[model samples]
Target: MPTQSDSTPTESARLLGRTRPAVRIAGYSAVLRTRALLTLAVLIAILCTLFALDISTGEFHIPLGRVLDVLGGGGSRAQRFVIFDSRLPRALTAVIVGAALGLAGAITQSILHNPLASPDILGITSGASCGAVLILAGTGGATTGIAATLGIPLAALAGGLLTAVAIYLLAWGRTTTGDHGVMGFRLVLIGIGVNAALLSVVSWLLTRATLTDAAHAQLWLTGSLDRSDWSTLVPAGIGLGITLLIAAASSRTLAALRFGTDTTRVLGVRIQTQQALLLGAGVIAAALATAAAGPVGFVGLAAPQIARRLLRTPGEPIVASTLIGAIAVVGADLVSRTILPVDLPVGVVTAAVGGPFMLYLLVRANRKATL
Candidate 1:
């Protein structure tokens, strides 16, 4: 008998399969919503257009047609070199880095049940920055031997992972019934404390460094894409691919989590296991982004919120947030590099714009409920 519960949202649906031609699998009948799909499609189109424009706006100034020709292997050697070797890497890096941060932010926020629970907020980016800055200050600005560029990313990744692990451990709880895991509010508080400490460490390191060393470290710490190239691109791309796979495989679990711990347990979700998996995946996503782009701020913090507002998804809008992150980064980078007479760091662009939006969101959220 078809249950009357079907009239409601898919919270009660078993799991829908082969829902559409290319989109396969899924839990919850409401997984595919029309407005949300349209929003995602539109965001993707905007991203592609921005990508073409980004490639075409450099010093050499290749037109859209010429950029397409070079991308399609029909342009002259000079055009090909400029498009493929120079501009494409920066634009692609921006997209992937933003997407990774956005996905991470969505996962973290959903897990914590708070809009402000992002990588930057949770001390992950601060930890990464501290590690990278340590290397820069110690090695005299990442210019000495293998310690220069290579050490920065490696140290940052390690620092982020370590910080995430610590936060999880500190937030872990034991119930009277013998269950144990993290609580959202506790995690946020611990993260804030850790972030402050890490920021102090970064500041101390910068102060100890020479002028040139400090300058290099500071520039990178701003999350600019200036240093991006094939080296950064390859690893960031691989990390994003792995992230998407993890996200797809864990969608049902994340959805279950959305309904609260009691409901999650009733629905057969191994609560501890699911949280750990999601948290680990999110940390890797954010850390990989920091490794590639030096902890680009606010993209992780703002993109997921934007996606949620736009798509109005019941569960975490992971896919939408990823696309929005990509779009945000590319658009911001374009503005930083083009509209401004000087080549401003992309991080500056995001922070300057996203800060006010974030403030407004906080005010609106406060109006709805006390925090």
Candidate 2:
């Protein structure tokens, strides 16, 4: 009973409505993909620039041309020594450590479903610190003849892994019924307690140790790139590779898990298994990075949060997080080296930046929850 003209216009309107969502979705998808690629490209450029600066801007002042020549295997002996002996190892260490911290932060945030739930937040870093402090203190504060350097990192890794396992076990409620927020809160409390206890132990050890040993221990606690050679780089690289592989493989599961256990389980995902694997991987990444870099605080805490804001997504931005983290740690290291005449610690720089950001996040989250 409708006129042809009216019917034709109605049909057109219906078609437009149906096609609009698809068009918008496609547009958004393209934008996200483009942004991700651009971010990665920018990060790579930044990393390369930082590496070159690290090589050329040091006290010896190696030329850019020579730095490139050394990189390409065509430089003089002095250039090779400067690039290889001084710059390459530090740069490589920064990249690996940053990548690990970023990935670990992303995984912890996603799995725990809390923006504040990073390795540092959940106590993994504190656990590692406890172990490192124990070794340094137990050796009477002397790294010179006590094999403390080798023992400390190992202890840190072990302590972090154990703490992670304990948290997971405690969070399991016969079938993983606890809310992620509750679990995260519990872990944070435990971590604080652990950290306090360890600090006390370290204080006791310092009092009993030799002055030289105490000074060495204090320096280690501050964190530095001076100890990062091929030896530290190799182990960190291996651990980072393994962590990234696990994260990539379990990404889908993590994405699903973000929507709550019931939804994830309904979609045929094994919630507990995936959670355990992700947590384990996070602990390993954090522990290795901590062992290498002396609890380089806030890289793990800040990287994923920054990635989430940049990507503007609900779930984990693994790729973005990794790149952002790499940029952050390397950038901080550059600042630490160049900004201060005396060379401040990398951990101190990260903490100084991260601590305020953390407060902002807490305030923002509180406002959102109230609304």
Candidate 3:
């Protein structure tokens, strides 16, 4: 009945031992890995579909077939113009900026061991917003033209980096002798205070500026893809690529750090140095995304948490969060353009969605703490 006799448990174990052990894992872990991969694949598919749809259903209303033809280099001149000149740039920017914010969020949350940690909440985005508002005010609200386009990103980057430095210093000082690493709660509290201060600064600038300048600054602060084009996309994409490489190289360190400072130190990682390096990478990523899209709200805050919940993982899934961030932005941009009576800024939609979700997280965390 048994062909060559069924192997015993011992025999099977011996056979497995003889095979490559590196790939072997427990059944539950294997299942989780498979699920995560499948989830990522599904998210990718969804994003691709949304991307095509985004290019398809603008004011001109090109069909999906024509969009594909244009993408494939086989469309009419007008079709090509509409696809390439008008719509494609915005879609690409949304995806790129979203992914950047997502990665930044993942790094911040993982490193700090706090689900609520995000660049937006940590004053980084507010800092970028402050820089952008300064530029708008200084230039008399000249948000268009060549100079303004180039200037905003640089200012935002500087502001974000400065804010990051400030936060690091403030959080570091609160660290006692017993505190082996940055305290997540302390860092978050300091960040919130900094965020409030920066927002006050932004508000003050807006009030002092002329009406036109104030309006322009307000629009940019709300986050929109109106400014995105080849020029913006190229530099932002490059920055994202560089930061992503740094994050990838630091993946093992990130993984270790997630287990807390003691475990990471035991694993021979220099705690403060590794944390600083990772935080720097996160700041650059957030700044780049903010520079491109003018501090798109709630994306960096929500993406990693959504991905972690989707994958049911203890730690944030970096790739999944990145994909989810792209999806959220692209989807929000789509809704902003098509579903509304008037075209609205992308951040408006995201804030609307993310606000309630954030409340839910706070409530859940409170309940857990009580329990």
TM-scores for every candidate against the unseen true structure: 0.88, 0.85, 0.90
Clashing pairs in 3: none
Given candidate 2, what's the lDDT at residue 265? Answer: 77
* Model 1 CA RMSD to the hidden true structure, in angstroms: 4.8
Candidate 1: tens digits of C-alpha lDDT, residues 1-371:
78665554454353443354244456534334667778888999999999999999978898899888778779999999888888998999999999999999899888788888899989999987877788767765545335544666678778888999999899888743467778888898999899999998888889999988888888888888987777777667776888788889988888888777788899999987888888888887787788777878888878888888897766459999999899989999999888998898888888898889879878988889874
lDDT for 211 in candidate 2 is 78
Prediction RMSDs, each to the true structure: 4.8, 5.0, 5.3
Clashes of 3: 0
Q: For model 2, what is the error of residue 157's alpha carbon versus the real structure, in angstroms, after optimal superposition?
A: 1.7
lDDT of 1 at 27: 53
* Per-prediction tally of clashes: 1, 2, 0
TM-score preference between candidates 1 and 3, better one: 3
Tens digit of per-residue lDDT, candidate 2, span 1-371: 76756667678888776652222464543223556566768777877788677767677778888788778998878878888987888888888888888999998888777777888777787777777777765664444323534565578789899878776666544435744423555655665565566666666767776776677667767766777777667666777899889987877788898886678779999776787888888888888787777777788888888888776778768888887787777887888888777788788888889999999989999999999
Residue 231 of model 2, lDDT score: 65
Best by TM-score: 3
The deviation in Å at residue 187 for candidate 2 is: 3.1
> In candidate 2, residue 117 scores what lDDT?
82
